[model samples]
Target: MEETVANFSGSNGPDNISGTPGADFIIGLDGNDTLFGLGGHDRIVGSGGLDFLVGGDGLDTIFGEDGDDTIQGSAGADRLSGGTGADRIFGGDDGDLVFGDEGNDTIGGDDGNDTLNAGDGDDRVLGGDGDDEMFGGGNADLLRGGLGNDLAFGETGNDTVFGDAGNDRLKGNEGDDSVNGGTGNDSIFGDEGHDTLRGDDGNDKIWGGDNNDVLYGEGGQDILWGNDGTDSLSGGDGNDQAYGGGGSDSLYGDAGDDSLYGDAGNDQLFAGDGNDLAFGGAGDDFFQGHDGNDTLKGQDGNDTMFGGTGLDLLLGGAGNDTLAGNEDADLLRGEAGDDDLNGGSGDDYLNGGTGEDQVTGGAGNDSIYGEEDADRLVGGDGDDFVRGGAGDDVVLGNEGNDTLRGDDGNDALIGGADDDMLSGGNGNDELQGGDGDDTLLGGDGNDTLSGGEGNNELTGGEGADQFNFDGGITTIVDLDLDLDVLDTSSVLGLDTALSILGSTTVVGADLDILGGDGSLLTLKDVTILDFADFLGIDIDLLNSDLGIISG
Candidate 1:
């Protein structure tokens, strides 16, 4: 067990040799051996045996070959390799190049910048300090880039990789792998197979390259992309950006302001807290803005989106999409295709931008607009204002004291069971007052106003307008005496000219036309003598249709 001063060589049997203080070269050949180059720049080789080799000082090179070996580069910049068998290799100080060549091995780059490779077999490797580069081979491996800025790759097999500290780049290349960027800004890639990747701290960028992968950005602002297959990604904190590149993927922005893009396939994105922006780029996708004011766009295909807990903007970009604003005041736009939009709660704005869309203001006082084509706009609850901007649209005031307008084309404005106002702005439109006392305004062109079951006021602004009544007291104002007509064909009495003339009476300053079923139509600011020529009682048609009135 005594130390040797000269460069020594071991025999084929088990031997122990320790070298000189100056630069020493020690070789262990065959059998199990222990070789130590104790000082200065040294070269130590354990050839063809299960051995323990150590390069103690200065810049050294140590190699453990042909058997299970333990190789240590104890000081200075060194080169170490455990070759051929299950080995444990360590680079103790300064910069080093360490390799675990074969079998299940454990390699550690203890200090300084190093390059470590776990070549073949299942291995465990760590880059202890300084900036380091580590590589894992074809079997299950555990690779850690510890401290400083580092780079690591888990190549093939199911591997676990960690970028422990400082800024690092980590990749899980093949098979099902797990990768974590423990601290500092990092970049992680789940390259192949179904993998799990996490950005534990600082701002990080992560990519799920192929197959179905799971990714998380645990802290700081992060960028995550689910590149292929069906993947799941979560941005745990800070403002983040997430992309679902292909296949059906799920992305979550757990906190802070976030933006999520569903690029292709049917993806689901949740912007959890913060004011976020989300886009369903292609294919049918789903989006949820869990909190804060968010903007969600269904860019293509049929997408469904929900804006939760804040003022949100939801757009149905293309295909037959569906959008809903779940809470607070929101804006919903059906941009293209036939879309359905709902403003779930609070005061909201809903616009059916194009194609035949269906828009609903779910609660609170809301403003709904049917922008183009034939759309159906509904004011779900509270006092709402609705406008059918173009095409033959249907505007319904569902509840409360609502206002509905038909801006263009032959639209239908229905006041559903509330004290409402219906306006026909242009073209030949139909306005129906469903229940409570309502007001109808025919702005231009020929229009039909029907006061369904309540006392109503009708104003025919221009063109030949028709007023239809169903019970209750109805008043007609701004009626062009010679152009507007009242169809009283549904009356029980007033079938003959004598009976129709007897029912016409002057009630206060208004001219009242009475029906047999206790219904009355009042012509405001007109005398019975002046309106008699506009009535059809004195004329008889060729078909003996007594209700025909020529205006």
Candidate 2:
């Protein structure tokens, strides 16, 4: 065994010292010295100044103490440390343990599965091209896993971590950080402050821990969670799963068919370009669906949702929500609370479940139902089917051949254009049929039926029924004329009957008795006995309150 100590000072030329092949000791002190332990369980030390320490062919220990240093453990199971100053430490060829104890250091495990620990200051640690483990101890650090399945931890301060190619686990334990899980199915965590995490190209699991964070699931079917604070997450390409956990967060399902959730706080979710399903679990949230057929639910709080350019399903689950189906065929449900629902430009279906609501069938053939409370429903242009479920409702079938029903509750129903059917089902209702020959059926209770401005049919079913005649062109047929009344208040210009026979037509004369428009009336299913009150009089005197013809 041999021992040698070589000291070089005063900014001189570098000194290179080596030991014998047996167990030996070599040390270099100051002034850019190089220390080498060439064989047999040797120990080499480089203390102060720019130094280099190398351990060769043995289970040796090497240390580069202070100033910019480089320490390499070559060809043996070695221990290498760069203690203080900006240093570079390499664990070469064997399973070695390496450390960059201080300063901003760059540390790598060259071959063998090794452990690289970057203890403090801003540092870079790489499990170099092997299935190794690395730790970023403190300060802002960069921890990368190379070519193998690795485990990386960014313990504190702002850090950047990459799981370069294999299945790796990257954890950012504290401070605002950036993490990338590259290529493999990795698991990543941003433990505390605001963070940015990417599950790049793998079916990875990425979690944004605390504070406001941003996460991206870039390729495979990944799972991302924005655990706290207001965060933004995107499922970039595959059919991924994302969640906004508490805080006001934003989640996007981009490209693939995805499932997203807003668990709490007021959040926003976008189902971008793919058929996706999104749920707004609590708080006030907003949801948007673009291009593909998607399904969205605003589960609680006052939320708004828009289904843009796709045949989507939108649900306003609770609280007062607004849902709009912007393009293709859609289905919308306002489950609880007072809601406003719009079906834009497609054949849509809308239901207002409870509370006072308003629904519009915008530009397509839509079916709208007011399932509870007082609701207002408008069937915009197409042949729509609109029905009012419970509370006092108002329904309007604006265009095309449509059907409007006010089921239960005191409702008002209007069939606006084209040949349509309007039914006031139960309760004291008001039904008005406008334009192109409609059928107005007032089902029950003290109902008022007006057949407005068209050759229409009016059938008043039960209770004190009032058949109103504006006389544009109308037909009033009371099954039991002995129990129904013909309201002649606005029918002052009504005509004397052209003919009246049993179960035959009673056509209009349009006689200008009083001052209203000269319109026609066809009273069917009645005999002359039904009109006994104005019998044998001129058509000018048809202005009396004819109550059931005094049966």
Candidate 3:
């Protein structure tokens, strides 16, 4: 039968009202009341005071009406809804459904994996710590997958969905989604729009779909993909792999042995720790091998590279390039175009082929060679060897035992640190030995020599000579000796005549010497000197010095 009950007075609820079919409103006097809908789909409303309603047996509808009410659905697949005011709805036994409408409400699935929906406002939906399903609808909602694998959906607005310590599936749908894969292998998806997905402390798989997304694989070896658009991917700890699929992207393999790829467009790749490999697939690129042994290649376009630590190899192919080996032992080669190479630390080797280039070995035992064109070379530290193969070049040995040579063209050479050897092979050159015992030669052309430290040997051969020895002894040995008897006067001029007389004095003899009017004079001893003075000097200095000049 169809029955209707209405109360004008705002009372709590009617104490103990039981009905079958028809819509019912059981009102209570300012006290708590209990109502049950036994048959047919019925709506029961309790106004003002606290009340309790149960939709029992049939497909009944029970509302917790107004005041703080407790509603339950016992048996039968019924729908229990809670009214405005703080209320509690329970799906007791059976696969029942419950919705806590408006006001702050608590909804739980008592038995049989039930569906609990919290409608409007802030609400709490619990799957009653069972293998149940909960939905936090509208406003700020909290859904907990207490036990068992539960599917929790945070619809619209901002929501907190937790797979609380179990293998659960949580999705942050629409609005801004915050999901935590608490203590279990959970699958979380931040679908559509801008979202934040974190694989918190597990081997989790996360997808930051569309828009600009931030995906963080917090711990463990996690897989994260930035699908479409520009995205930020970080593989936090563990050996992680990251990919920047499209757009200008940033990928960081924070620690452990990580592999990073910049696929298409100009992208930035950072392989932060462990032995790492970085690739700048296309376009102009920048790469940093922050730590561990690394391999960097400037695959295309003009690129700049830094080999940060450990032994590294850098190849600059095509385009003009700049390579710096920041620390540790490294090998650098400029394959094409004019390039600049610097070996910053450890024992380094640099080869610049073709094009005019500049190369420096910043520290450690370094070897540098220039293949063609004019080039600049610096052997920075440790025992170093430098060769300027062709064209006019400038080579400097900054420190340590060094060997420097100007192979061709007019070259400038500076020898620094420890004992060093320098050769100004061809062309007019300048050679300086900054410190340590050094040997320098101006092999060709007019060259200048500065002997920096220790005893130095210098030669200004076949050219006008100037020699400076700021420290240590310098001995000038005449390499051009007049062994030709026919050309004695040309070799032994006034200077040679005085040198001969000084040599005789060293043997405890005093000899007075005089020069004849443009005629060569040789004073062998006192007897030969007096006889030669009386004969008026000239029987040819070559013959007299050779003992052919006799009194």
Candidate 4:
């Protein structure tokens, strides 16, 4: 039964006491008691058994001093503490200080600038308003910093922490924990064990300290650091910057123009949307720029990068890397080490920098450079421009009207199909125009130029070069009569140079080969006497068909 008390001192039995509107004092000194401080500044204490205490109005002080208790500071700026046993505490109105001392407890600072200390045991605390500070003490706890600028620390144990709706600072100190920075600009840390940290809104800063961890920058322009261990970090929205420090980590820039750094170990970095930048530092890493114009750098190991969609720039620094510009006009540089690069679709620029590398310009008009070492460059479709710089390189213009340049070393340049231009710059190089009305330039050294099919134009720039002609109308320009020779071994079935001179017939200014299945070799600015003097043979011996003529 409920009893009205001016000063109630109960026995070792269950008691219910209510206080008057004036200044009152009530103490339920033993059994499970129920006390209410209805008005004025009152003091209520449940000194022994399991009790229910409520500070209903003005400035009040409520204590759950003994057994398991339920305490509520319902109105004014009150001070409440759940002492000893497991308790549920709520500071329901003004600025209050709530203590969940001993045993496992649940605390709620429902309004005002509250201070909640979940001392000892596994506790759960929610700091509901004003600028609040919460501490999750002992065991695994869940702390929510609700509203206002709050501070939350999951001290010890594996805890779960949330900085909800305020500019807050949250830390999961020690154990493997999960922390979220919700709403306003916040700072979060997962200190020690493997943790999961998320920056759910506003421009926040998150760190996953020690062990293997995962972090997500869910909104705003945030910064995330996955320090130590093999970690995974994602920048979920806005222009965020994420760093994967140490171990083999994975970093994702999920939206906006983000920057992701895979610092150390073999990592995977993805720039998902917006114009992003990603760095694969140390170890062999993988990077993908899924949409937007991104820039990806593979700084130390043998990394692989793909520019999926927009115009991206990929740099493979220091390792044998593989880079693919998956769509649009992108730029890829395989700087140092032996690398492989592909410019998929769009007009891209690819540089196979240093070591022996392989590069392909897939579709669109791309520009490919095989810089240093013996590299292979293929311009696949569209009108591409390919340069094989230094070493014994191979350059292939796979399709369209492409241009292939073999710069230095004994390089081979091939125009795969259509009308392409092949230049063998320096060294004893080989140039082949596979189809269409192609142009082949054998630049410097003892070079060989072959017009594979269609009506081709072949130019031998310097040194003693050889020009091979086949079934089509082959036009030879700047061909030295004394130093360069025409190779008609495939058309005339004659391997020796004397047999080629004996099988040529000059019809006007062109030398017609009779046994090439109607193949015509057009020698520009050269007559029958000029060809005969260069061959150092009788002019009639070169003019005679020897029963191998048509028409």
Best candidate, TM-score = 2
Residue 105's lDDT within candidate 3 is 88
Q: All models: lDDT?
A: 0.85, 0.84, 0.69, 0.85
Worst 10 residues of 1 by lDDT: 494-503
Best-matching candidate per lDDT: 4
Question: Each prediction's TM-score against the native?
Answer: 0.89, 0.89, 0.59, 0.85
Total colliding residue pairs, candidate 2? 0
Counting only residues 3 or more apart in sequence or on different chains, how many pairs clash (N, Cα, C under 3 Å) in candidate 3? Answer: 5
| Number of clashes recorded per candidate | 0, 0, 5, 0
Summarize candidate 3's per-residue lDDT along 215-256 as a digit string, tens digits: 777777767666666777787887776766666667777887
Q: Write the per-residue lDDT of candidate 4 for residues 432-544, one digit (tens) a residue.
A: 89988888888889998888778777778889988776656666666556677765546543221111322244454333344223333323344333544333223463465
List candidate 3 stretches off by more than 4 Å: 1-140, 192-194, 227-232, 245-252, 262-273, 280-291, 294-324, 331-341, 349-358, 367-376, 385-396, 402-551
| Ranking 2 against 4 by TM-score, winner | 2
* TM-score of candidate 3 to 2 decimals: 0.59
